[model samples]
Target: MHITVEFGGGAELLFDNKKSHDVTLPEKDKEWIIKDLLIWIKDNLLKERPELFLQDESVRPGILVLINDADWELMDTVNYVIQENDRILFISTLHGG
Candidate 1:
């Protein structure tokens, strides 16, 4: 399946400073979920300081996840199933002062 993954609010720094990624997930025997996407990103996209982006297999606190413009919390967070053309956005609320 194909999707768009975006990072913002300094989160893109962890991904080589790029803000958007067009990803084509490999076909899996089971449906892909946000949890699986996180792993995929860690393996394929994340360039540094993973600890700042993820915690316990999920996005760390202060990060907001939106799926297709809706809050991921409303879509079951990491359990939300990925679909074709879905847009996933990760924005960090943590900013160094």
Candidate 2:
């Protein structure tokens, strides 16, 4: 299955273009979702700060993950059932100046 991954803060990427795309759950793509997401996050955001993931925190300080506009904490998390066109937004939490 194919899903459009849209990062918050104006980032966008597409995946699974080798087969017919649909909204249903693709067994083959399940594991890839979590692994791919971590890879994306690590590569895109923490490339310069590889120690981010090493910290002991639940939600982290500067990262926010939203699935289709809703917080991932409210969803199934990494196991959340994803669909075609589902938007994944990774936002950086902002603090007061």
Best by TM-score: 1
Q: Write the per-residue lDDT of candidate 1 for residues 1-96, one digit (tens) a residue.
A: 999999999999999999999999999899999999999999999999999999999999999999999999899999999999999999999988
Best by lDDT: 1
lDDT of 2 at 4: 49
lDDT of 2 by residue, 1-97 (tens): 5554444331222221111222333456345454455554454444244443323423345657787788887976666656656766655444334
Query: What lDDT score is found at residue 45 in candidate 2?
Result: 41
For all predicted structures, in order, the TM-scores are 0.97, 0.50
Model 2 stretches with alpha carbons more than 4 Å out: 9-36, 40-47, 53-61, 94-96
Count of residue pairs whose backbone atoms collide, per candidate: 0, 0
lDDT of 2: 0.49
Cα RMSD (angstroms) for every candidate in the order listed: 0.8, 7.4
Model 1: residues >4 Å from true position, as ranges?
none
